[model samples]
Each structure stands twice: as C-alpha cells, then as structure tokens.
Target: SDVIEFPSSIGKVTFTHKAHQELLKDCQKCHASPAGGTIAGFDKDWAHKTCKGCHVEMKKGPVSCKECHKK
Candidate 1:
C-alpha cells in the first residue's frame, strides 16, 4: 500500500498504488516501455497524459486537477 507523491504548484498529487493495481491488473498499462519491455521512467507530463487519457476514455475516475491534487 505504497503511495507515490508528486510535487505540484497546485498541490501534491498522491497516487494510491494499491488502488491502481486493483483497477489495472497489468503493470504495462502504465509502465509500458517503447522497446516493449518494462521501466519507462515516465515523468510527470507522461503520467498526467496517460492517467487523464485512460480516465477520459473509461469515463471513470478523476480527470480534473482538484480531484487529484490536494486543494
């Protein structure tokens, strides 16, 4: 139940690893590498894009800033 936090101007973004794992069974969903391996070392922009993209497509989860960032 490790929570990864990212610094932001609005607020820190706390990502719940357990929750994401529960929702996405495969790690590749977000950790997919260009070489088709593992470990992409994605940055904040990539995370924001991927997360918001999936959330937008699934029509579930939070896409808004305030929803994820602490206000």
Candidate 2:
C-alpha cells in the first residue's frame, strides 16, 4: 500500500510506505522477509523506536507527535 494508517487515541499515524521504500530501497529494513509480510512484533513502542528512531537518526522524517499523529 502507498499509505498505511494506524489509528490511535491521539490520532491516526499516516505512514508513507512508498516514500520509505524509495529511500531505503530495501524492504527488509522494515519487513521481516524480502517477500514483504507482517512484522512479527509490530506495535506502538516498536514503531516509536524503529520508525521514529530512524527519522531521528536520519533527520529526514516526522519526529513530533503532531507531525505523525494527525487528527
């Protein structure tokens, strides 16, 4: 999917899958297998650590709550 939306109490987190794929150029970065399937232990904390962490490290993505969690 181009955009993956995660609904939460705060707001809906809109993930731009296509954009990440274009930059990373490797599905395994987020996917468990090259085939691309569900992440074994995907959750909020994991996303915050992995996704947000990547954004922080790369300094090229949304890191704030309002930036990601849209109402």
Best by lDDT: 2
Off by over 4 Å in 2: none
User: Candidate 1, residue 21: CA error in Å?
Assistant: 0.7
Against the reference, the lDDT scores of all candidates come to 0.77, 0.92
Please write out the lDDT profile of model 2 over residues 1-71, one tens digit for every residue. 99899999999999888888998999988888888978989999999999999999999899999999989
For model 1, the superposed segments whose C-alpha errors exceed 4 Å read 33-41
Q: What is candidate 1's local distance difference test score?
A: 0.77
Candidate 1 lands at a TM-score of 0.78
lDDT of 2 at 28: 88
Q: How would you encode candidate 1's per-residue C-alpha lDDT over 1-71 as one tens digit per residue?
A: 45778788888888887788778777778766423333456676887888888889999988998988894
Clashes of each: 0, 0
On the 0 to 100 scale, the lDDT of residue 54 in model 1 is 88
